[model samples]
Target: MNWNRYIKDYQSYLRIERGLSKNTIENYGFDIERLCLFLEVNQIDVSPLKITDETLQQFIYEIAKEVNPRSQARIISGLKSFFNYLIFEDYRNDNPLELIESPKTGRKLPDTLSVEEIDSLIAVIDLSSNEGERNRAMIETLYGCGLRVSELITLKISDLFFEEGFIKITGKGNKERFVPIGKFAQRYIEIYQKEIRSNLVIKKGFEDTLFLNRRGSQLTRAMIFTIIKSLAEKVGLHKNISPHTLRHSFATHLLENGADLRSIQLMLGHESITTTEIYVHLDRSFLKEVMYSFHPRK
Candidate 1:
């Protein structure tokens, strides 16, 4: 099959079977497109079904020069998945990337903000502006719930369950989880909903969306990043903060405060405990304290 047909089929598989997000499907498609581009540039003619391991390795070698190890690893993983899909369909007898190894890149811990820094960042919001309340509420919700930017943007008004102390989150693969929202976050959201959001003319089909832009449309992920970047600059914070920074800080702060990993994982919507264990590396002293306080020998 042609590259386009293969990619389209793969995308359908990801969406229908894997339930991956659009961004994830696009990323996987981009990896294949990169391979196609390389093949064209090198005057090589090969279909996805006919591509050999040697040719794939050559493309990877060329890609290594242009991207970091982390990106290279992602590309390799994406390509491997595509080839495995082909194998699953019986289009190919064996996978091209089966023997190839991903580059060794050590686990990079996420950057986290201190509680004071978080407070300082939120304090810089211009509360007098119409969006001020919304911004504060958004930041608080982000930190309080440990939500991804995508989840935050798509959050619906119906998802808030303040009376029950929980907010429902639709995480990766469209998996839903109920995270407990703090009193502070709930209060700010109520304020924004009653005062700021109530004043706006919400567009059709977005009436249920909790957070919105001034145009009454749902907020974009880029807008969320821009908001955080502006707040970080206003506070003179040297850290390169993003929406994810608040999330990491949420997890880190909880772990440091003696919250269990499993609970944090549930709140953070991490499917694996190992994903939550990274927070342990953030504070060795906290781990030591836990050991000393809880160990029977001490």
Candidate 2:
């Protein structure tokens, strides 16, 4: 059988048995696919069972030229899982990736913005333009609810449970979760919906999508990144900011202000508390401040 068939079966196992999220499963598939492509390009006819440690290491070395250690480590992990699955099913007698070590990586904290910086970025939005309101709403929703760019783009009008102060987010793997929508995000969406979105000649399938381009179609992820980058440039707030940065900032700010980590995890739609624990490292001073301020008779 071709490698792609095994890959398809592996993806299904990830989805059904492992219960991994869509984005994660895709990442897993992506890692394997990269190896498959590399092998094809080199005319190497080695099957998964036939792959040697030397071959895997050579592939890793090639990948290291483009990506950082963290990305390399992640890909290694994904490939290991794939091989382990094959071993489990008796398709392979041994795992080729078992001897490969994941590249060492330090825990890199995410960049976060202060409340003032976030406000400055928002303040520069030109309210006069047609897209201004939509842009504002987009930023607001990003920071307001801490949504991933994918979630923000896929946000639907009917998903708004505003009466319950929540919005249904279709997260990784199409997992649905109800996240609390802050009043600011809610109000901005309301404004955008009434003022701009209401008048657009929306496409049939995308009629329920919250954010749309001027052509009345769903916005692309690149478009969202461009919007954020331009706004960051306009304000001259110097930090490597993306839509995800806004989200990191949102979660960081909440954690700094003493929001419980579990709640933040739920809001961010993280499957693992470990993923959410990164926020704890963002604000060390917050921990000190919390202890000093709240400790009895301090």
Candidate 3:
């Protein structure tokens, strides 16, 4: 099949069978598209089933010169998955990337904000503005629930279960998890809903959406990043913070406060405990405290 046809099928498989999110599916497609672009630019004629390991290695060599090791590893991983899918479907006899080794990039820890830094950032919000209450509620929800930016934007009013003290989250691969929402976050959200959102003329499709722009639609992921970046600047904090900084802080702070990794993992919607273990490395002081509190030698 042609590259476009193979890509279309792969995308459908990801969405239907694998249940990956749109952004993830797009990323996977982009990796394959880069390979296709390389083939076209070099006038190399080969189908997905016919592409040889030498051609893929050449593509990898070209990309390695232009991209960092992390990006190179991602592209390699994406290609490997694509070829594996082809093998699963009986389109290929062997994988082209079977022998290709990914660069050994160490696990990068996520940047987190301190509790005081979080407070200072929130305190800088202009409460006089029309969006002040909404922004405050958004930030609280982000940190309190440990949500991804995508999850924060797509959060709905109906998803809030204040009486039950939980908020339902649709995480990666459409996996659903119920995370406990703190009273502080719930209070801010209630204030915004009662005072601001209740009066707005929400758009047709966004009636159920929790966070709305001044235009009365769901907020975009970029808009969330811009909001957080502007707040960080206003607070004079120079940590290169993003919406995810709040999420990392949420998990880190919880661990520091005596929460277990399994509990943090569930709240953050991490698929594996290993993904949650990075927080253990973030705070050496916390580890020292834990050892002193529990170890016999201490």
Per residue, candidate 1 scores C-alpha lDDT tens digits across 1-298 of 2799989999999999999999999999999999999999988788998886657766876787799889998999999999999999999977877645677763334467898999998899999997899999999999999998889999998998888999999987589999999999999999999999998999999999999999999999889999999999999988778887898899888888878889998998775565466533456677688889999997
Per-model TM-score versus the true fold: 0.67, 0.66, 0.66
True-structure Cα RMSD, model 1: 12.1
Runs in model 3 lying further than 4 Å from the true structure:
1-108
Instruction: Tell me the lDDT of candidate 2.
Output: 0.84
For model 2, residues 148-219, the per-residue Cα lDDT tens digits are 888999998999999999999998757899988889988888898899888999988998888999999999
On the 0 to 100 scale, the lDDT of residue 115 in model 3 is 89
Q: Residue-wise lDDT of candidate 3 within 84-157, one digit each (tens)? A: 98998899977878756677663334457888999998899998887999999999999999998889999989
What TM-score does prediction 1 earn? 0.67
- List the pairs of residues colliding in candidate 3: none
Please list the C-alpha lDDT of all candidates, in the order they appear: 0.86, 0.84, 0.86
